[model samples]
Target: MTGVPKILMTLGAIIFVVGFLMQFIHIGRLPGDIIVKKGNTTVYFPIVTSILVSIILSAIFYFLGKFR
Candidate 1:
């Protein structure tokens, strides 16, 4: 029970840091991401960034679990 709050706080801090970095880093503009721009409309998707983030987070969790 006590560990739940600590985990939530850690996750929140990680999310806050990522949000802060996204403002300065064009993470959504990485190559392989989809960007459609029409005369008056624009759509964007960060596929590559999402994959990279997934892999990184998976590795982090895997290692942490191993250590535990």
Candidate 2:
């Protein structure tokens, strides 16, 4: 129980920091991301951004598990 709370708090803090940093870091508009504009409708897909985020998260989890 105690561990769960600590984990949640840590996760929340990480999320808050990421959100705060995102204000200055444009994350969704990577070069490889798809964007389509047809007349007035625009469709956007952050494929590259998703992959980047996944890689970063995987590395973070790998390091955390390694340390644990």
Candidate 3:
């Protein structure tokens, strides 16, 4: 019960910080990300960013599980 709220608060704070940093960081433009542009059209995909985030989250959860 108490742990639930603590976990929620920590997650919320992490999300907030990530969101704030994203405003100034070009995370979507990292290497291995895809970008297509035509005269008046553009498409973007953050492949590397997705993988990096996935790896980070997986590690975080793995360690948390280990501790528990």
Best by TM-score: 2
lDDT of 2: 0.96
Model 3, 1-68: lDDT tens per residue?
87999989999999999899989986677889999999999999999999988998899989999998
Candidate of highest lDDT: 2
Each prediction's whole-model lDDT (CA)? 0.91, 0.96, 0.91
Candidate 1 clashes: the total is 0
Report each candidate's C-alpha RMSD, comma-separated, in the order given.
1.6, 1.0, 2.1
TM-score of 2: 0.91
Winner of 1 and 3 under TM-score: 1
> CA lDDT of 26 in candidate 2?
91
- Score candidate 1 by TM-score against the native: 0.79
- Backbone clashes in model 1, listed as residue pairs: none
Q: Positional deviation of 56 in candidate 3, in angstroms?
A: 0.8
- The segments of candidate 1 whose C-alpha lies over 4 angstroms from its true place after superposition are none
Residue 30 miss distance in model 2 (angstroms): 0.9
What lDDT would candidate 3 get against the real structure? Answer: 0.91
In terms of lDDT, the poorest run of 10 residues in model 1 is: 21-30
